[model samples]
Target: MSLDTQSPGLLAEPQAVQATADGGTRLALRGDLLDFTHQPEWGAIESDAVRFREDHWLLIEDGRIVGAQPGSLAPDASWTRHDHRGRLILPGFIDTHVHSPQLDVIASHGTELLDWLNTYTFPAEKRYANLVEAETGAARFADALLAHGTTSAVVFPTVHKVSADALFAAARERGMRLITGKVLMDRHSPDGLRDEAPDFGARDCVDLIDRWHGVDRLAYAVTVRFAPTSSPGQLAMAGQLCTSMPGLYMQTHLAENRAEVKWVHELFPDARSYLDVYERAGLLNARAVFAHGIWLDDDDRALLRDSRAQIAHSPSSNLFLGSGLFNWRAADEANVRVSIATDVGGGTSLSLQRTIADAYKVQALQGERLTAWRGLHAATLGAAAGLSLNEEIGSLSEGCTADVCVWDWTQGSVAQRRHELARNLHERVFAWLTLSDERNLVTAYVRGIARYER
Candidate 1:
């Protein structure tokens, strides 16, 4: 199907057809179903309940999951069934931190945190000021996410309100659940990327929220570029936007690089730490998702836990930028919620599988292992919780949007050979996580409809 096909209604109804089994017509899954529930550690990790039947059935009617279980035959129910056997079914991956404007610069070279933004990131983002460019980029970005099995994302757009509008429009067109905001930076950014004033930025944000938020599956996030880029007035305005907009999510960078930390300390001398800058601005709260909490001190962790704010741990970006390893265990001990993310552009890959692999390696350096189940949970359910979007798009539960991904574990020669030696599900899952990239994604669905089917 072409990407420009007619956009569906907010709760679009799926087409209905008849299914047959045992010489009787009925509603059922077209093939075997594999579902994952609860991470291996169960209690230690977040609960991720899932259910899918083998050659079983899901009766989807009116764009909602009516039933999902194993049964012999039902002669009365009319439904169109999809056969997804030999494929793993899981919730669509939620990317907690990513820059939609950075789609073209994902693998650029050689600049540390702040330098990278000034050198390459900001200039690239400035292109989104044009509505046509923003729309095209938004469509491409959304397509890439769907192609890679990322069903939802908390995205950062350029400082232009049109950037957020373009992304939201594209997401709505594709029937995706996306949260995003126009980057608010009143100072310390290039001329084209900087806003006129804090109040003006706030006004634009309010406008975008009114237009986009709650329109279908989209949400609005109050995005601050970072403490260093935003003036005190701008930060306060971002805080005000958060306060005024109920259920709005807050996103910003924090303590990613050593030099960045030193700069933050120099800029906000009175604040207790880098996090304290946002905390004092009323920007820290339950719906807040801070990226790269690598340099967080003990008190910082405590404060994050106290506020119930979540962290988007971008291991790939941290490694690429030479930032220190994140202390996941320390954050865990402090009762902080953490989710894995690909801090793309700064992060090297768009593949959640690669992000999971990098996260496993990062944890290993800290003398810990992020298990296959735990990594998968972080990519899906855990990340959704971090974004405060768990109820809508996290797992394969009945009533949840049928955003699903099917993986071809043995797609490549290497994978096929590795599959031959794998003995168990866990081992196979581990191998896929470690070795699989975007090539392994066989098909991707958004809201019960196929967005990309390989």
Candidate 2:
């Protein structure tokens, strides 16, 4: 299942893959293993929701986790060992919503969502029309995600077909589990960046899907740039593709800001709410992921729950753009699937740690505390489950792909002191989450093969 046989593209770095007598790779990671078994309750962390094996050896054969043994392996063991004793070995982070071409626009000043997109995001993405620019950016962006401990992601590429092609090519070279598609926006966008014609955009998407979807670890998303930018015909075209193409994913923004919500209401007066616009287009389904979703009403949530669609909680982006706080508890109560993401560029980082730290603060502003378990789950297993890829990418359990990251218990001296003073696993993990970032990541592995190192 590994893409290691393919020639390294722009970003592949050399890493050893152990060869066993069976003519397959075998390896083990020795560390403090942790992953969520299920979704945890709100406001407080539950012990049962977590699976923690202290100082365990996570066994891997070929590209999947075979078992997790609690002690050292036999002295004559033939497997290659990457000893990360005293560190945390967990599933690689999964980012549900992020823009790949916006890597250069991160940290740019902006007034709000629309303004930000015009001033920074659009210009950066416009560059992707060039094949060289698209390939170079995609390669650097994929490398950056792994460097930040993200092994799997649902991405947003530019409106150019070349953008999605370049991104998939880069991901294939690195064996990353990546999903993206050419963005569709036929109106309200700049001349060079807009699709210009809905039918042409749909045709491009079809061609890209035939070429890339389900190849290696890559998948295609039917990316709509929100209802305002897409006409009724364009949205219908996107919906048609979803129905025709089984297992295809759909991603778009939904009520991310109050103004954006109001704009949706004005644009689609017949629709009940912002989500209703997409619903009427037949775009609501289990594979659909709407970003932000900060302003959805109870009725909208009920619709999402019924549709089995998901909301991607992008805390950093919300705070940066003055988007409202996400009602994590409310969405969960309504049985709506929710996952955490970096929403990069609009978000301040590619680091999920920053996103999770901001998530805690956002929930706190709403008079709720985000447990480390809840935050960790949202980024790891929960995100994977949202994409219906949990059985493959989100856990260290047997039969799951071996996409993993090793993290130090603490980073700076102050963070180390806090961890040392903690009285329990909960406190230690909270401190680690608050204080850690990509710098704390010792290494990241995709399919039991090391891909990034500090």
TM per candidate:
0.90, 0.96
- lDDT for model 2 comes to 0.89
Enumerate clash totals for all models, in the order shown: 4, 0
Q: Which pairs clash in model 2?
A: none
Residue 35 Cα positional deviation in candidate 1, in Å, after optimal superposition: 5.2
lDDT of 2 at 161: 93
Best by lDDT: 2
Looking at model 1, residue 374 earns an lDDT score of 72
Backbone collision tally, model 2: 0
User: Which candidate has the highest TM-score of all?
Assistant: 2
| lDDT, candidate 1, 1-454, per-residue tens | 3333432212233333453454333333444444455433522332234333555555554444556665455324355556655655666889899988888888888888888888889889989999999998998888888777898998998999898999999899888999898998887788898878627488888888899888899889999989988988888888888887788989999999999999999999999899999988999999999999999889999989998999899999999988889988788778888888898988888899999899889989988877777777778877776676666667766676777776766677888889779886667777888988777776666776767765
Residue 291 lDDT (model 1)? 94
Clashing pairs in 1: 29-57, 31-55, 32-55, 33-53
lDDT of 2 by residue, 1-454 (tens): 2332232222255466678888998888889999988888876655698899999888889989999887565313578887888899989999999999988888888579988888888888889999999998998889889889999999998999999999999889889999999999988889887776636488899999999999999999999989999998899999999999999999999999888888888889999999999998989999999999999889999999998889999999999999889999899899999899999988999999889999999999989899999999999999899999989988988999999999999877899889989998989888888889988888888988788776
Over 4 Å off, model 2: 1-11, 198-200
Worst 10 residues of 1 by lDDT: 7-16
Query: Poorest 10 consecutive residues of model 2 by lDDT?
Result: 2-11
